[model samples]
Target: RRADVFAMDGDTRWPGGCEGRAGVWAQLRSSGDAIGSARAARWPYEATELEVLGEGDRRVVEHGGFLRAVERFDHRAFGLSVAEAGCMDPQQRLLLEAGYVALHGAGARRSALLGSDAGVFVGIERPDWALRNARQPLGSRPSVFSATADTISVAGGRLSFALGLQGPCVSADTACSSGLVVLHSASYAIRGGECGRALVAAVSLKLLPNATLGALFAGMLSADGRCKTFDARANGYVRSEALSAMVLAETRIGGGRLLAASAVRQDGRSASLTAPNGLAQRSLLRACLAQAGEQRGRAHGVEAHGTGTSLGDPVEMRALAGVLGEATRPVQIGSAKASAGHAEPASGTLGVCKAMLQLSASQWLGNARLRRLNPLVAESVPPGRAGGWCFPLQPGQDALSSAGVSAFGYSGTIAHCILGAGGADAAHERGAGARAAVLVRHSFIWYDDVQPLAQHVEAAEGRTALRSPAAGALLALVRDHAIRGRCVFPAAGYLEMARTASCAADALTAAATLRGVRFLRPLLLDAAEGLWIACEVVAASGRVEITSGRDGAEERALHSACELVGALAPAAVSKPALPRLRAIAGSAVCTAALYAAFREAGLEYGPTYQTLGGAWAGDGGSFSVARLRRPPGTSQGVLIHPADLDGALQLTSLLSPSSGGGGGGGGGG
Candidate 1:
């Protein structure tokens, strides 16, 4: 086996922690193979008798091989991963694989899987819980696998559960090509920065009994137990079960890489289940090859389907020959069917695994039954085993193909994956860490019923929303100036400070009751996380006493002295400071409306000390503090700022979290 791609090279093989164990594993696996599958293969291992509970710290296996023991009390030992360990289902297998990667440090299950990022799972779910446990007579379908059969969805959930990723969850129904398509989509997501890493899993479960017989009658199943690709006697396909997984990280490995990929279509131009399209196949091959920089041909080599079907086989060979063109040096080729039968939706994934396996073992395992039929035999399946590929490989070691994954979905979609060597790069751009982005929040809620478009004004680097006004009190002039007229402060009055004072006028009562308002100044909650606010002052001697209202007190009376000055005041008004003093508390009230809008968008706020008369003084009024607390028999111990009580919008007790709900969010007017 070629050990270069994944060998942890003694204390340093994989990107990080996948080493050491690979070494021990390599030795053990070699010994296991040496003993051969002869005796082992005969006694079928039953799931009923054998239980696989993952354990021990030697999870990676030292030098490389199969793990038969449990390390620490990992949730994965229960089945597949931390999420799946509690449940037994087909998804358990995928979870197991995910758990393996995670324990090895190649997994991204914390935030990405469960938080900021999204995920995708591909597979059939295991038998339904109800059906699996029910007594026979009460069961309807006898097997619950039909409805709850696809596990791909659970993969998405498990990944999300482990990683906190939450972008998009999709389960494709592309048949045998589903696994490859899943990988392709995941790669695209990485390139698109939707996620930093993706877990691509493929699996197949035994279908409802007679599903094959039904296919057999439909002519899709080969009556002959064997499958031969590109052979004169080629008939049909043998469906089988297979499971595999490969983690796709956005970063590129240091050594070799899978540069590019292309998927073409046969349109109706190519044959369906019985025929292959050479032209379309070659087009895709060329596209993938073109991505290789200066690489000769489309790939270093190609892996053939070689299902031995008379009609299907030739088209595949012809497709290869067409892609290869006039190159005197023949292209290296082979098949995975030589070992395991075609695994349906997992077929392409299986091929990908074989390609990886070949790169690992440096061996080209030959067809177990076929002698030779194609004229393009420049070298055998193995070049080093029977001493290299001069003829068909006897066994052992040889190079097969650097690229060899192709699949045709019944949906008329065909895809090819280019195999690659491995290593990790720290420089790769990934959208996985902390990201602070601005989201458009409030659009106007119009009384005219017009759709108010949302204006998402982003922070243009170094942008800060300053707290322009926090306290203010409106006074003596017109009670309804805003309804028909606009008011201006006196020449000596600081307009901005007046506005702040006015907004602050209503706050004193609430702040006093709550033992003083403590604004989490400079609140930097993200737009996605929701609304932000802060504070500036404590109005001095502010009292909500009514002095002139004839009825019960609705109009608060902190402006008593100003009113007294006004009444006595033709003379007092002549005083240098009387007009400005009278305007100070009255004007601070006008800032309320403007400040309300800022409260809706999540942002940081800083005090805008805009008083003109002097620096730092409380609202010049006679307000006495009144403490407010949640009344008895109430669960919400909230201190609602009386000034903003009318604008508060409370949410239901329970809410389903959603991003569209706005990250910087809290209900408000």
Candidate 2:
């Protein structure tokens, strides 16, 4: 498949610990070497399992891929309450995370997805959350419905709802082949013009104790805690946890392509229901090749559904040998399951992701845990090419143009997909410029240690809501900024609030200029208790009003109002042209020292109020740069932050040194 955008989160040694497709791809450059004990000691259930299984058993070791930040969900990012998020499954949480990343990777704008015809197809098989909830005593807490967030159907529907997608939302389960099946379904929907874009996701989380025991009893789990794909030492597969997602759009839409998908089912019967049928796999491969409109020789490689099982590995290889034997080149072959462990329902998506990475990196990944090739697979190996996973590419090697991904469900259902090069640039190349953007480094600086503020914009009527918790903790500087013996929110705070709201609603290329401002009432400190501050876009004239009060159906006091001028303007480049400007003494002091100065001046500036930097008086006026710093648990966006403007405005009072007592209060507009 042409990977216009993909996202993955699994174990890896990347700088950020493999949170995205790039992270997974970087880890795939070499054989997976991150295998380790699953840390049974951390949990009583796993520890008990280990104790019962004994040291000699690989099940005791229980190695598999686990995510590092499973508990760290940004509930506010998805607009879910803490209670709602707690009741939700981690699998659903991960799907939301990965789906959003994939959409952004595909250059799909957030506004477009809202109320747009974008289908969502997700693969999910585990019901660990539901099982765990069932074991708990049904206490006073209300029962959580299986269809709410625990059901597989909600896995896709939740993402669609969160992003306001109106297309078909389906969750598929075909055992290990579920991932490919979901992806194949999404492709058909796109080709059939059912939706303009499709979000396909596969997620697997092994969280319950009973599931491990089931796999152990089923003889499907690796006793040695490794997936030795294509190796003689292969015994069984190791279960892993992962989230893989992709964004698909029709090639005619001018983005990427998921070339072709061919799914087949064993009509009669196999050696057993779980046993894979080689002939069925071969037929599926041929059908996939034909659907891709290419002969065996035209293919570049095959990402086999090699789970390292004693019986399954050989069956998959024999099927590949029979189908790819006629290819012109020694077709490269590999499996991500060897490195990342088998992600069950998500493994098929992981394999396709690996194929895309291989095409982009122009190198076939070496299968991990492969020391000795199985006799059956070795006998079918063509001359010149090593029987095991192919070696890494040397310099100047051409990248593979077409590849095949095969996933066989334990239920005797086989699915194979053929993907060819849709673009010269791989996933990395497509996002290189964005990945290297300076905004990546600076965009997060505006948000402090608080829940990010959500922006709601109705551009049709030129209205937006930038609602957030008030900066009560930032009353340090403004502690002395009072009018009539009452602390008043600084005028600059209003400006920053208005500008930020306007910017969020306007095009990213443009900024807002505040004018026609008026202050209706002083924002008293005590009046803000149990209240939220909001900046609302009032009209088509670009007017934004900052208000504070209780939630809906309550009167909100109008703290300040301003008319916003929205237009494309060149970035500020010219320095301030003034007669004379001087730096405020001790402006370069450390934060503590600056606070000490404020204390000496009897100006009790809190975190947000202490934004004034060096100040100077010259040419019959005073000037200073207000270095507004974000307060703890508060977020700001405008370069000319309200706090900064207030700090700078304070420079005017410096003209009268006697005003240092915080007594010279005047109107600012």
Candidate 3:
């Protein structure tokens, strides 16, 4: 089965706590070491569990993964009552929040999902909160809400209900493979016409001590709480907590797409119930690759299900080597378990997310804590193949186009999925054909007048809207003001736009004072997109709001707002005396040194905004003379020059020179 993943998000509490996809990618690209000492608070009976396992000092199970602020959630925002929210499993809460974020990231709001044929598929184990609730006294039981809140089966239904979705809602539990299994199920449902879109989520939490005790008894957990996958020192996997969600659709929507998926059962013929079968894994990989058809060989790497087990790691490597066969270049393989610990049911989906990020960035992240390779696994593959098996210790560029993700359940269910870059086909589908050219016989017939503001202005009862093309003389000036390596519209430019609108709307020559001015958000200019700006004025209250967005988008973001008091009388236009300016000009501070200090603090000003020609400093306040480097032509129709205003405002830095806090002003004339 195949489907497009529009967006994905998650919250994780591995060695280093992270939230959302960007945070996770940052962690992976940087250290990729989220394994550390387990806290006693996470498992109160740590000592007792170790004693029961008969652990020696050299190999004690004293470490596990954890996160802070586990109990933090906003119940009111989700429309949940206090009592029901209290009884609800944290896994359920995480899925609900992350699902909402994922949908939003996909450019679909919860309102958009209402009554739509969008499915919800969740992969989670039995809730630890339910066990804790069962341990309570019968007399204090809140039976009505507990049934729906604590049950893992209702997790998908709860999300569907919250979004008013009408499509299939299914929850799966297949041990470690649960994440990828749900993903595979969602793809099939979409392909089968069961749902037009789907939200797939997986969550795992190490809340109670019993699960850890059971793992210790089964000899499944690592003693040092580190997953040294494909390494000789590998012993076992470390348990971690994670909640991840992704949105899938039939048509591509600016994200990675699944190429194929295959699942197989190992049966009970293996050496042990939990032991990985090489033959089964090899078959699974081949089946998945076969389903990918011509696109199979495009895969650049594999995200291995490396649990750090001595037997499991070797068997998986052999299966991978067998499937890869002879290749021009060795295929790189790594695992998220090495960096973030085994999130069990959530690990499979986490691997898929990592793969998507790798493809998007065209870079491969190194595995953490893999110091030495296992001799048996190294010997199984060819010399060249073995060399490519090891990933770099730091992030490096690779021509990544596709990736393979594997997840094997301890219960013998195995799943493999292939993901590829979907942008090319999407771009082709969205392509606009060449436009026909017009032929003119005479020069007089082809002549046209250019009226920049006249054609863009739209006037209504309360608002005056203006359109600014992405490319023009005004945008050229805006692009000249770069900050932090990006072309950002200056704060003074917003003030200028607001003032120009105020004068036109209120029938004034010029706005005398702007009160309670607030710069809410910066206007970031994109070369390919034009801007739509609206100035809404409340006549009675004198309130003005300036908002801007992409030309064709419905929603506009507020950039600047203020109260426009009417124009000043002719008598009040006289200049005041500047005694401080005269005194400080004699002992002026160097303008070059001041700009250098600004650069050190990350405020990069371009040639247009660097109009601070002469400056001065003193204890009272500080004074500066600023002038525009070149004349802004009259065709621009600007009431006041933004560059000159901005340069004058920059003089405020001298008031608290030593502080270097980079404070901003609230209002200005």
Candidate 4:
């Protein structure tokens, strides 16, 4: 599962669990052992129980292989207030982070997903943390409503809300099989043409005792602090905490593939509520293979739902052996639970993640904590031949072709997904004609020096320099903030650009401060052409200069210039406080009304430039809330984008003496 992003599990290997998939995989590959231990100190009750019964008496395995600073969320990043963040379920926070990681891994932008037909499907089983927190009294801390912040529906809705996604948002729970079931539903939604893209996540945080105690008393927890999946020592599962997310597009966005997925439900009368039906699982596998357009014998590996239980392990193996026995090669089987423990609703997701890693790695992964296999299942699937870290080399051939991930929930829900390695053909198909989809730039400016903000740094003549193409899309937004019927790129836009450039500087250059910024020429709006912006460090004192002109001119005209600073001297004198500004006693002007008024005055402003609220005085200046009219539920970035800040300046006209009716007039409403 860690290989989904190759993020390292920093908690196990470093100070914080931020190393990502690569780090996590490296640890697993090297140690080849279970990573967690039974906890006595994490919870007071568990500690007291351990103290009374001794350490050996405890059976509950504690897993801390989770993101670092779980409680410390960057509210500013998601545009949430401290109060809102405080009220949010910790699982919600984890899901948000996972969503971001998944999106980034998929090479998709949050801006693109927002307002698009992108659905959110989340699998969540534990609401104990939210319930417990809800019972606490609201003292001096921020108050949280249990119905909104802690609900399971909010888990999926939170993601959709935060990203401005307009597609269907659903939360599903089918006990341990929830994760795979959610994926199943998402795949169908894609097939049914409900959404173009989908975000699927499984988040579980073990913070409350009731949820754990219930499982423990039900004899579902292992007597030892290990998930010995498929081993004769198998007894029960180890509970785990995981927040995993994946972005699913109809077509592959990256190297991974979702060949097919299938979900099935068994009748309740067939067995006990917790019993797993081998017949159902076998049938589910068959259906899955068919959906994948693969034969029963084609898959090279299987990521099993091996929870290390005496009853469940054999049943699952039988299903696998029966369905995949016809394969030319042994269907390599493994369980993520063997290394990371069972993440309940997230178990299926982890299985899929591991399968993707194996397909990409072109090798069969070894089973951890597996020694002697269950006797009943051994005949159909041999212990040694079943699967391991086998690098089978067929003379010159390198890697296996395909693998399948299986998950069977106690709710009698079965889900299976097939994954295939992205071959040269697949890559070629993905990349075919991708250039044609790129935005057509009609500008005369050549894009030779154009670079992304992240890759703009270049050292030349003892100075760090950057060349950026004026993006037409960004300029469209900037063109909206106007003064006197003229479109001028805002100084704030340049400052923002400088700040972004400063991020590429070395540690010695603490910050880049601009001074005496002057705008020599206005960048008029051009439908077919865009300006080219450039920045360079000029002096040793962290002074960075910026200029904008023609794209390909050898010596283009400069539009603006300013000095940059890394640090500023502390001020010795305090500035005098100004009188508080008051809202004008008049009807407020809506953005549309203001724009119409501007049009009548021969000063037309679009959505980006129509920032005026209402005049506060007879002089024509007012300060109103300057908010971007983004799609409903879209989260704002930490710093306001340049276009937004510039748009606010449009309100000054109402207070200026140049206004037709002086400052006292109401907004041309």
- Model 3 RMSD in Å is 24.4
Best by lDDT: 3
Q: How does candidate 4 fare on TM-score?
A: 0.57
Off by over 4 Å in 1: 1-152, 222-224, 230-233, 253-259, 264-266, 269-274, 293-298, 374-391, 395-401, 422-669
Q: What are the per-residue Cα lDDT tens digits for candidate 3 across 581-626? A: 5454546667787777766665677776677776655544433433
Q: After superposition, how far is residue 99 of candidate 1 from its true place, in Å?
A: 6.2
Q: lDDT tens digits, residues 318-376, model 1? A: 56555554443444555655344455566666566555555555664444445556443
Candidate 1: TM-score?
0.46
Worst 10 residues of 1 by lDDT: 446-455
lDDT of 3: 0.69
Q: How many backbone collisions does model 2 have? A: 8
| Superior candidate under TM-score, 2 versus 4 | 2
Worst window of 10 by summed lDDT in candidate 4:
2-11
Q: After superposition, how far is residue 668 of candidate 1 from its true place, in Å?
A: 72
lDDT of 2: 0.64
User: What's the TM-score of each model vs. the native?
Assistant: 0.46, 0.60, 0.60, 0.57
Q: Arrange candidates by TM-score, descending.
A: 3, 2, 4, 1
